[model samples]
Target: MMFNIELKDVGKSYGDNEVLRDIDFSVDKGSFTAIVGKSGCGKSTLLRVIAKLEETSKGTLTFSGEGSKDPKIRIMFQDDRLIPWKNILSNISIGAVNKAAAKESLQEVGLIDKEKDWPDQLSGGQKQRIALARALASNPDILLFDEPLGALDALTRMEMQNLIEELWQQQQFTSLLVTHDVTEAVTLANRVIVIDKGTIQLDEKIDLPRPRERDEKFTYYEKKILNQILGG
Candidate 1:
């Protein structure tokens, strides 16, 4: 097994306004990890730091394994961020080198036939699927998700979750998800990390089996994380 990320004493600040401090963690290659924290608790900042979008104020960060060095890291956000005027094919193919690759990725995300449809023609989940296809088109070795499924209704959100899990299993890409939904975190990640006050509050592995049902153990982990988020 290869190590995907090694972040030690990582901290971030913006002009003396500290947003993250003393963060440390290791993520293994091809693993899915979920980071959960309340709003403004620096969860998103931590994700950005890991993605190298924001330079770390202090600490050492390292990436290893295949594609780990100069890895193609991509991020998916709560908003689909699709261009309204662009057709679906044009939108998902933004990073693709050519049409074939774009069409392949679009099919991978189950939206092949929607290529000619406009963004407004799609539903929330469909737009998210397009965003996912766009990210996949880049062939990223690492995927960072900032609650991309947060905007959908319960049924749609669950459907997207399944889709993400399926895609991850097929690609075996190292992934990190930042979400406020504890259940969602527990349901998807092999490990659940709780961030509080810009620091890691808890790091627990999900030993439950895959295709995880909302069983007792799953519920227990969800409650445990929820309690921490509630400051219990």
Candidate 2:
């Protein structure tokens, strides 16, 4: 498998606090990989390092394939992070509005009509949709999702999950999602990495096909992943 992102013996620290150590992983091009773990397990910190938002203290990071240097990487945070003063359309475009690209991206997230609306005018789910639209607008090669669905209600979360799965299939970007939801890991990821105590404890692939429904089979797989993360 050709990897778009590679981390070898990576480590990060804040003075005496070692947030991550000796991490190694590779993300295959266009694959959806999820990092799941308890809070304070350094999942977000690890993601920050991958996104280049933070520099690692040790080891090497490499990128291969198209336009590797800046590689069109976009990070979607838990908050929608939309500019309140800007209309949804402007917010999604974020100063780089190509009429065709912005419109198509917004439509993909089901916010085409809401483009003119203000950020405050939309529900939590709608706001998130706009955020995803913004991330997609960049035509990113890699998309880093930092608990982007953490704030939604159960029903909305499910809907957003479906929307994300659809978009991933359509866009085919290498995606790394840092989430605490085990069911979400099972539902959306091609592989799941369990991050614990500043390092990856388990890395398992999901052999299930795409468009996975939360059926009995999914539930069983979810339980197994939950156990692995919980160290059972």
Candidate 3:
């Protein structure tokens, strides 16, 4: 049940202020794409439109694939968004298949042992892992990440990145990630799209091999994206 996403000539606005203009973007099924841009550049808006959280002011957004129904989509945000009252297992199992399925999702994020802990009992990174598990428990066909690692410290962020990549490779779900981190984008995404000033500025393919290192080629893509975002 693979699904591909398409957005043709999409434009979004609020009143007189345009957030996205004449955007033409498409995401291939089972590929990881990262959207990068400076703050207020409408990168998140583009994702929201795809997620159908907000409607486009103009243009078409559609999904095409095996069935007539829409694809199953899930989003993981920067905030963990966990229930303080619910234990970790209950949190992931809230809308999940069952407790066993929720436990599997927790295990995938390396937090099965924390299933008994409260959200407040865990650290920031642990909370985010629970959030990821919750999103995964749904068995989404498309997983959207909105800077989920933004709040973690450097080492924990790297670990989370590795976990995400591992799970993504294993699950093979289509992923769209919105991040301000160029290095992270290069590390995780098959393609990187740069949104600038309410429009698509650059769409660059990351041709490097996986388990990516911050080597010369990696930095090259990073610098290129950073420059584009910085208006270089």
Query: Which one wins on lDDT?
Result: 3
- Indicate the worst ten consecutive residues by lDDT in candidate 1: 64-73
Tens digit of lDDT per residue, candidate 2, span 1-232?
1239999999999999999999998889999999999899999999999899999999988888854455778899999988999898888877344868888899898879998899999999999998999988878888999999999999999999999999988878899999999989888998999988998888988888778877887887788778877882
**Which ranges of candidate 3 are over 4 A from the true structure?**
none
Report the C-alpha lDDT of model 3 over 1-232, residue by residue, as the tens digit: 5579999999999999999999998899889999999999998998899889999999999998786568888899999999899899999998787888999999999998999989999999999999999998988888999999999999999999999999999998899999999999999999999999888889999999989988999989999999999992
lDDT of each: 0.91, 0.89, 0.92
* TM-score of each candidate structure, all chains considered together: 0.96, 0.95, 0.98
Put down candidate 1 lDDT per residue, 165-221, tens digits, no spaces.
999999988999999999999989999999888889999999989899999999899
Off-target runs (Cα >4 Å) in candidate 2 are 1-3, 95-97
Question: The CA-based lDDT of model 3 is what?
Answer: 0.92
Candidate 2, overall lDDT? 0.89
Model 1 lDDT vs. the true structure?
Answer: 0.91
